[model samples]
Target: MGAIICAASLVTYTSVSAEEAYTLTIKDHRFEPAQLSIKAETPVTLIVKNLDASPEEFESKPLRIEKIIPANSEANFTIRALKAGRYKFVGEFHEDSAKGELIAE
Candidate 1:
């Protein structure tokens, strides 16, 4: 009985620590849903999908993330828990047109 109880408790803890996921799409050299909001102090999984025929680099200074997504492909990134604030990101290949912000509240 004690062993079963411990197993249940472990399952609950594992579920609680799992980060929520969000998706962003790159189309026409721009990030769809240019702005996103998430819970503060909670880790998150960011999935970026590139629909364009060319590759794009997801770059963010404040978030300290950088990745190059291939054309018509997708990539996943793990973002640590964050404070209540806004973090800006851009596509290094198309800085002028590809811009977005992540808002934590």
Candidate 2:
């Protein structure tokens, strides 16, 4: 009985520690919902979906993330818990149009 209880507790902890998820879509070299708001000091799972016919590289200097998302597909990224501030990101293929920021508060 104790072993079962311990196993259940572990499962609960695992779920609680899982990263929060958010989605961003790319179409016409632009990010939908260009500004994202998230909780500070919480790990995040960012799902970037590319709707265009060309691939795009998602780059964020502050987040230290640089990933290539293939055309008409989606990619997942794990972001560590962040401090309260804004982290900017851009699409390498279309920096002028594809720009976004993550605001953690």
Candidate 3:
């Protein structure tokens, strides 16, 4: 009985630690819902979906994240817990139009 209880506790803890996911869509070289807000000091999963016919690079200097999302595909990124602040991101392929920021508070 004790062993079973311990296993259940471990599963609960694992689920709690799992990162919460948020999604952003790219269409017409722009990010839909260009601003995102999340809780600070919590792990997060950012899913970027590209709905355009051309590839785009998702980059954030503060988050130290850079990846290429293929045309009409999606990419997932795991972000570490962050402090309360704003992190800016842009698509290298369309810097003028593809812009967004992550607000953690």
Candidate 4:
């Protein structure tokens, strides 16, 4: 879990919000929570850790961010939610199965 915590801390480190930035993990072919509720319009950090030995891509069209998370590595990005919306994203390399979402509040 060293990588996961590192990814999360990378995200949290950039934040100055009282709401607190959160860490999201991707492992076992799934996004752990699969769904997330975050403070809307607040600058949020998403640290994506890919535990698999294969490269994975993370994307959220509604959130307008796409990142390539290397095998056993992580990617960090910032997003500001404006309102409640379901942002659907997935691994481009494994789009058929590696999928997930972001539920903003």
lDDT against the true structure, each candidate: 0.96, 0.95, 0.96, 0.76
Cα lDDT tens digits, model 3, 1-105, are 999999999999999988899999999999987999988999899999999999999999999999999999999999899999999999999999999999999
Tell me the tens digit of each residue's lDDT in model 1 across 17-84.
88999999999999988999988899999999999999999999999999999999999989999999
The lDDT, on a scale of 0 to 1, for candidate 3 is: 0.96
The segments of candidate 1 whose C-alpha lies over 4 angstroms from its true place after superposition are: none
Expressed as tens digits, the lDDT of each residue in 1-105 for candidate 4 is: 999999999888766454446667777767767777777767677778889888887877777877888889988777775577777878778777778787778
Q: For every model shown, what is its TM-score relative to the native structure? A: 0.95, 0.93, 0.93, 0.74
lDDT of 2: 0.95
Q: Which pairs in model 4 have colliding backbones?
A: 41-81
- Expressed as tens digits, the lDDT of each residue in 1-105 for candidate 2 is 999999999999999988889999999999998999988999899999999999999999999999999999999998899999999999999999999999999
Which candidate comes out best when scored by TM-score? 1
> Which runs in model 3 stand beyond 4 Å of their true positions?
none
- Candidate 4 stretches with Cα past 4 Å from truth are 1-19
Residue 8, candidate 2: how far off, in angstroms?
2.8
Flag regions of model 2 displaced more than 4 Å. none
Candidate 2 local lDDT, residue 68: 93
Select the stronger candidate by lDDT from 1 and 4.
1
